[model samples]
Target: MEGDGPGGTGPVHVPFGYIVASEKWRGSQLAQGMQGKIKLVFEDDLTSDFYLSNRSCILYVTEADLVAGNGYRKRLVRIRNSSNLQGIVVVEKTQMSEQYFPALQKFTVLDLGMVLLPVTSQMEASCLIVQLVQEQSKEPSKNPFLKKKRALLPLESCLLRTVQQIPGVGKVKAPLLLQKFPSIQQLSNASIPELAQVVGQAVAQQIHTFFTWSG
Candidate 1:
């Protein structure tokens, strides 16, 4: 997803975790408050107000903007159509603006498939944005909330697989052997006759030979 502009085709270039704020948004209450928490870069060509990364940006709607009309929707629509940036809307949700938020949420989240975050004031919004930028800067693996692609295998399945790796073991014999011996160390310590109680004598002898074989 390209952010700020169409030409950001490769990697996200967030050097030292800078939040690219729109020139129009510069020196605003949000920008001023964020100065102490993050690095802010002012630019004129961004479709959104703040670019968190090359692929993610934020669009801020103040209480005045919400009460004004659906004007912010046009900006949001432009961002949705122009670039594939992850748009996060930080809207003022005070008593004056709360009535408009439901409709705004529908347009941004339900319609545009963007993230909508509500803050009571510019100060709170600034704090929230700082946390977002900080979290985004960290490697994805370090964030516990993010879903992982590959879930760990269950312990029973792992143990079953380990048992089946022996010389003369299969799915059928592995579970039975594990039920009796439980661990690799315990299984290796079993005498041939003791192993034969679970698996047959031939397989038990083979198992003993596999564990004792120094080759």
Candidate 2:
């Protein structure tokens, strides 16, 4: 959206990430200020039809909304893994971060790359939006050659390494073990019955022996 510039000499068009404002933040000062500063497209629901096609970073007004057990959170996590959209959650400074740290950790573990912004209140949120716009504007174009320079993770090796770290699970069984338990945390905590269900009697006994080995 074009608007009169600060001095009113020309139109100011600030490129912005798609802003999906929640109903709770409607009529707030932050929302009002954002209208003038960026090219905002408002939505009543955080997970709307727009986000499915638009790959813009989401602007959440509160941490609770971002972490809530809802379809919105599910879709956000799905897109983060498959797309380039950044999930930025804005929380008030007055709120304790510890309360939301677990949720943040979950996002990190899922590779969602969710960002947290702790502001004093809604007013500071506007300042953050301005800063984001300025920084985005200054970003240099990417070099096509740099794509080859980026290091790629060896998934098979990494998965084997993690599974093998568990007792009784080695190279031969690590791949099958992972098929049953996708993550190290899950493999480490699986009960004998659960392990046996996937890897059978003898292997389950070996796994149980490894985790229970007290020596």
Candidate 2 has its poorest 10 consecutive residues by lDDT at 145-154
In order, the Cα lDDT scores of the candidates are: 0.69, 0.48
- Across 1-215, the per-residue lDDT of candidate 1 in tens digits comes to 23555233333345557887778878788889998789987766556787776656778999999999998988888766654455567789999888887787667644664456678889998887887777665554422312223211122333455467566898888878866875555777799999998898999999898666643
State the lDDT at 162 in candidate 2: 38
Candidate 1 wrong stretches, greater than 4 Å: 6-13, 142-215
Off by more than 4 A, model 2: 1-24, 44-54, 59-72, 82-84, 109-111, 139-215
User: Model 1 compared with the native: what TM-score?
Assistant: 0.60
Residue pairs in candidate 2 whose N, alpha carbon or C atoms collide under 3 angstroms: none
TM-scores, one per candidate = 0.60, 0.42
TM-score: model 2 vs. ground truth:
0.42
Report the lDDT tens digits of candidate 2 across residue range 48-91. 22221123333343544434443346655553454333344445
**Native-vs-model 2 lDDT?**
0.48
